[model samples]
Target: MKLICYLSLGSPSLEQSKINAQNYIDAGCDVVEVDFPAKDPYLDSPYIQSRMAEALASCDDYSEYMKTIEAIKAKNPNANFIVLTYENTIREIGISDFIDFCKRNHLKDIICVGNTHPEVRKELISNDLLISTYVQYHLIPEEVEVAQNTNGFIYLQAKSGGKYHDEYKDLKSIIRHLREDVKISNPIYCGVGISTPDDVAMVKAAGADGAFVGSTVLKLQEKPTELKEKIVALKART
Candidate 1:
């Protein structure tokens, strides 16, 4: 299973984010999803929100974020990078400019939190950037269509609500529904509170292509060794 780790641009520091990105790459994360610090990360939990807030306060502009991407790419040219940010940040930077920046930096995949619409979808694709969206419990026709159209893995949110901390619900049935009913051929990645090797194994057993982990990995910020160990264990399970 592909392991996707979340790292914030400004959290700790832009330089430190680069260090952590390299560390995670060395530790065996297939993709490091970098979050562009936002004033209000509506989809994130308090743990991540606080760190993003710190990052926003410390960094003067998006230059550090661009530099972080460059540094990570320098460390590993084949490293996979995904940007998980709000729409305002993308719009503030200007869609065309953002697309050009990502293209120049070799970044492609993006998860636009709090913004899932036709225009957002159209703009990303027009610039040759891939888009990703969430798949919840109730699969609406439009949601299924989005999942079918996304280039990367279909993000299967393993929870019910957008509260402080969402509980992980069993996704076997949801995955089944997506595959059988919706005919979603894109890779499915179950995430949200997926912290254990057992959780990763469960996703793999349920026919998912990978596991997306963020909060749990972020909690190990102070313990680099443990973080690597956890990632190794998670990868082994796959």
Candidate 2:
């Protein structure tokens, strides 16, 4: 199994997001997720917005997202980046062109939320499926069909909605069931409500092929090398 860390680019200041990504890379996270900023209005989280404002103040333009990837890859050539974000920007920017650009530049993947646009299918390479997570709820089943047809993996959310608090004691069985219900071998990764190395253990036991960590990782200190070590230790526990 592999791991993908969500790196806040659109949603977070470039500096902070890069710092967070470097931390996870150091901790042994298998992959990274680069999400767009202030995406969900319902968050109604003033505090979140406040934090986001600070992050975005220093954020780079969307075009720099790819440049940053190349820079990071130059340093950590083995690491892969997932261009995690909402789908609208893609449409605005021209999906086909972006997909071609990503492949040409060597980006690992793109994870989209709140959409399954018919046109989205043309974004990835000939056989790349648009990755979906459980955050969308009630949409996974239909989305899975898209996954099957589009060649994208079905990413499962392991925990309940909202951030993963320390209160979430154990959820291995639940993760297992989600994977089984999906009933496919096409790379299922669980995310949301995960905090700590133990959570990684639970998801692995649950039969997930990989795990996704975002806010939890951002809460961690910067330092990609060390972060990767921590991730490896946690991942091995399962």
Candidate 3:
């Protein structure tokens, strides 16, 4: 099973963010989901929102952010990176330009969250960019269609934040539906509320291909040893 770690560019500090990224990769993360700081990261949890705010406050320049990512990539030559950002960010930099930027940086996977139009998704896919399809607790028909059509992995939410959907009783059932009913062969990675080794074990048991741990890893950023141990423990479950 893969372990994906989330890192906000320039969070805390550009130098420290690079350190954290290296630590996460060294600790056994298969992929790092890097987020470009946004003014309003409304979809994310409070923990992630604060990190993005910190990142923007430190450095809002896209070039600097790209340089930081480039530096990180230079250091970790074999590490996999997937870009995660809001649609507004992409709009700020034209879609074609953004695709060029990603290509130059060798980033093939992208997760453009928030109300993005289907045409935008199609354009990205047409340009050979792999974009994730999010599968929330509530399995709506539109989302199912997106999942079926996605060329990238499926991002499955592990925690519903309080909302309940009767279509699927549990994560396992949801996984089953995606596999059997939806006929989605792409990797399904479970995120949101994933923190502990137990959570990783639960996701693995639920038949997810991977687990994404973000807030918990960010919380331990100041403590490098503990953070590394935590990632090691989480990866062990997979």
Best by lDDT: 3
After superposition, which runs of candidate 3 have C-alpha atoms over 4 Å from their true positions?
A: 116-119
lDDT of each: 0.78, 0.59, 0.87
**Model 2: residues with Cα > 4 Å off, grouped in runs:** 10-19, 38-53, 125-130, 133-150, 160-182, 222-233
RMSD (CA, Å), each prediction: 3.5, 5.2, 1.5
> 90-189, model 1: which lDDT tens digit per residue?
7776777778888988787888876554576578778887778787645555777878877766887765454321322346777887788767887787
What are the per-model numbers of colliding residue pairs?
0, 20, 0
> Which is the winner by lDDT between candidate 1 and candidate 2?
1
Which of the two candidates, 2 or 3, achieves a greater TM-score against the reference? Answer: 3
What residue runs in model 1 are displaced by over 4 Å at the alpha carbon? Answer: 116-118, 138-142, 159-170
Query: Each prediction's TM-score against the native?
Result: 0.89, 0.73, 0.94
Find the candidate with the highest TM-score and give its number.
3
* Residues 1-238, model 3: lDDT tens digits: 8899888778898989899999999999999989888787888878788888988888888778878888999899899998997878777767887788888889999998877566666778899999998988777779889889889989999877776568787889889998998789999999989999999999999999999998889888899999999999999999
TM-score, prediction 3: 0.94
